[model samples]
Target chain A: MQRAKAEFDATGVQILAISTDNLNGPLAMAARDGLEFPILFTALDPSIPQAYGVFNLFGDGLASASVFLIDKQGEIAWKSIGKNYTHQVFPEEIIEQVKKLN
Target chain B: MGAVFGRKNRVLIAISFVAALLLLTVACGDNLSGPSLTSGQQVGAAPSAEAEQPSSAPTPGAATPAAVAAVGSESKSNTPPATATGAESKPDASAAQATGADSKSDTPPPPIATAVSKSDTSSAVAATETATPTGTPVPAPAAVSETPAPTSLPVLVNTPGPVAMLAPDFTLPSIQGPEYTLSEYRGKQPVLVVFYRAYW
Candidate 1:
């Protein structure tokens, strides 16, 4: 994420990272990892993850890692849902999906 | 002294055997919980999909992709083979179930907004065949309009274009500053939303 932020920004794509952790943990993580893109937390309100159909997906009372590419018209252009705790979409796959968009 | 040492050795062996039994019991317990837990994940999408299967089969325009994505992702940990196979057969119904499930969060199925490109319409037609045989051809229009026509239902959305599922709108506080609303970026820029399971 740190490496691809500038490239994503160049393409006018905003990267928003939402975590299942509470407010403070993600805040500290952003500071620790030097995450420049916006880091949003869903601990206070979990409706966001639930909306995306990923809340408690792994049965650990937490969200499975996932990614959604929302087009300019607010429609989901591409999405990859994590099947387990370790699953995640890579930066290259994300770039590829972004390129597919108009 | 020799007699006493022999007795102590027997006691040590007994203790080790008891410890081994306890470890095996815990391992077996986890094995038992594993299927139930994984099946719980399947239940989230399957039951709902199964419930709406009959009604949602005809309208595969906008919902096909989402259903395909859901089934693809969950295929690996498919604990219940029955639901997985059933979901695979008719993903369009699962798409409606997905919309219904997420409706509480205000994430409606994507409204087919504009004319689908020739290639897209062709592909959507191919996809529609998996859901229904008598798929209606989507009417590709030339005129561009800013306001999306209120084509919400599958019965009424036959002519508009291919369906695109919309992301649910959300507003949440960020580490950077004040809250961010997802819909605010619509029509301005595309957004990449990432959900992470923070280790901390």
Candidate 2:
């Protein structure tokens, strides 16, 4: 989220977005949208999203949308899996959650 | 015996024809309507399942977000945030920047892939269905499909562990040169991993 970049960086929180699209698509998105963070390309394999459990329910590649808040020690601190794809984890909410982890 | 065999053969032929027809219909959903739908019809087709996806082929700047991509990055001077946008404009500048930033990244060959195959692959989705006739391009909330009411309800999916459990550690490449490992970032600082469906 380019809009929340300052806040995320201020908190020392790194943001990474992994998509099933090729690195090219993500690269395109980053440049056009002025994304300051990292957006990884998964190619055809859904490893990142699958492990993150975005497709924990139904569908293929990327299914249900989800956010994972993993702590410094790589423990599950908080996770919000949207009921539907459109339900997003807002920046303010994430900012609060990140602060609590500190 | 010959008459009985002929009768059975005719029944099998009829069944085969029906099966072939069904497959053809599903496979040709795009051809059936995609071409006919002028930009005018594409306005409505944007959100329609008939436009479910051109195909799953990975394209640079061509993945469709599950619903909407709201990448309207406003002026956040100190920190640059990547807001999602529904429009999938060509990322000439971004791709160049990406290549410039990361030397380690093996530059992917420019797609000789015609922009036309986009009808076949989900990649190449320029603007989303919500991209208005007015050209303002609104990022509407992504719905699962034409009828999203059913999927809007909660459903079960596998998790490495519950909220308190240790997250599974794995490595994924960063768009930049570095590789992201869950374990590496653990002791240093908090990391949030966001998996977007695709970029529309």
Candidate 3:
């Protein structure tokens, strides 16, 4: 994510990450990963995940690993809902799809 | 004497025939004019002239009639101005030069923000002089530009709130070490609050 942000800094794209982890966990993760971008902690907020239609109730009782490509027009251009965290989509594919939007 | 005269005559005739053939070859070559030098020159020169003429020149008359229609279409298409037929005549070198010129034109001179800190001595003297001139009263210099008033950020609307059907506002510490409230940040920038399990 940091590498992607560096490449896209001048392209006027902003990335905001949100995690359901507790405050301490998210802060530690940010510090360890050296993440320069913003990360919002939802404090295990199930409502947020459910609203985005990514909540996996049977799996982890949280949102699945999903990538949503929202275009400049605020429309969802592409979405990939991975079944498991290990099957998460790559960032390059997300970028490729996003580039087509603009 | 008869035999010698006949041999001399044959030799003279052969030499004369050779000389006449050489002269004829030279005359024929000169009159042919080597396949029209002017036409060859025109063929070489035509490409350059065509290149100098803008690619759109042929379509200019048609373009004018649809100028109004094109303006509406162009904004939606995000067509590159560089690809326009009229712009193609510009050589790549000139295009680069034009880009540089455009960048320079668009860039404004640096504001006095940086100079304000370094020239404190000069500013103090100037302030003293101004105070002296207006002995009765003088207003302190106010900032010309306020910290650009925070812009209203976009927020996701029509999404269910934290409460049933009501999007609940929450506060979370920002990665920048400042605590941010979703409702507050929403007024400045759209917030996409994703809730994902870290372990899973």
The global Cα lDDT (0 to 1) of model 2 is 0.46
True contacts kept of each: 0.89, 0.76, 0.28
Evaluate residue A24 in candidate 3 and report its C-alpha lDDT on the 0 to 100 scale.
Answer: 80
Q: Per lDDT, what order, best first?
A: 1, 2, 3
Choose 1 or 2, whichever is better by lDDT. Answer: 1
Count: clashes, candidate 2: 27
**lDDT tens readout by residue for model 3, A1-102:** 556765545444445566755578777877887886678666676665555556663476766666554444343446666566665566676666656655
DockQ of 2: 0.28
DockQ, per model, reads 0.34, 0.28, 0.13
Docking quality category of candidate 3 according to DockQ thresholds: incorrect
lDDT of every model, 2 decimals: 0.54, 0.46, 0.39
Note the residue pairs that clash in candidate 3: B152-B188, B153-B187, B153-B188, B153-B189, B154-B189, B154-B190, B161-B166, B161-B167, B162-B167, B162-B168
lDDT of candidate 2 over A1-86, digit per residue (tens) = 67888999999987877666556767778778878777665665765565555554455445455677888877878877767656
Q: Choose the strongest candidate by lDDT.
A: 1
How far off is each candidate at the interface, as Cα RMSD in Å? 13.2, 11.0, 23.7
Candidate 2 ranges with C-alpha deviation above 4 Å:
A56-58, B1-163, B198-200
- Report how far residue A77 has shifted in candidate 2, in Å: 0.6
Q: What lDDT is reached at residue A88 by model 1?
A: 61
Off-target runs (Cα >4 Å) in candidate 1 are: B1-162
Off by over 4 Å in 3: B1-200
Name the top TM-score candidate: 1
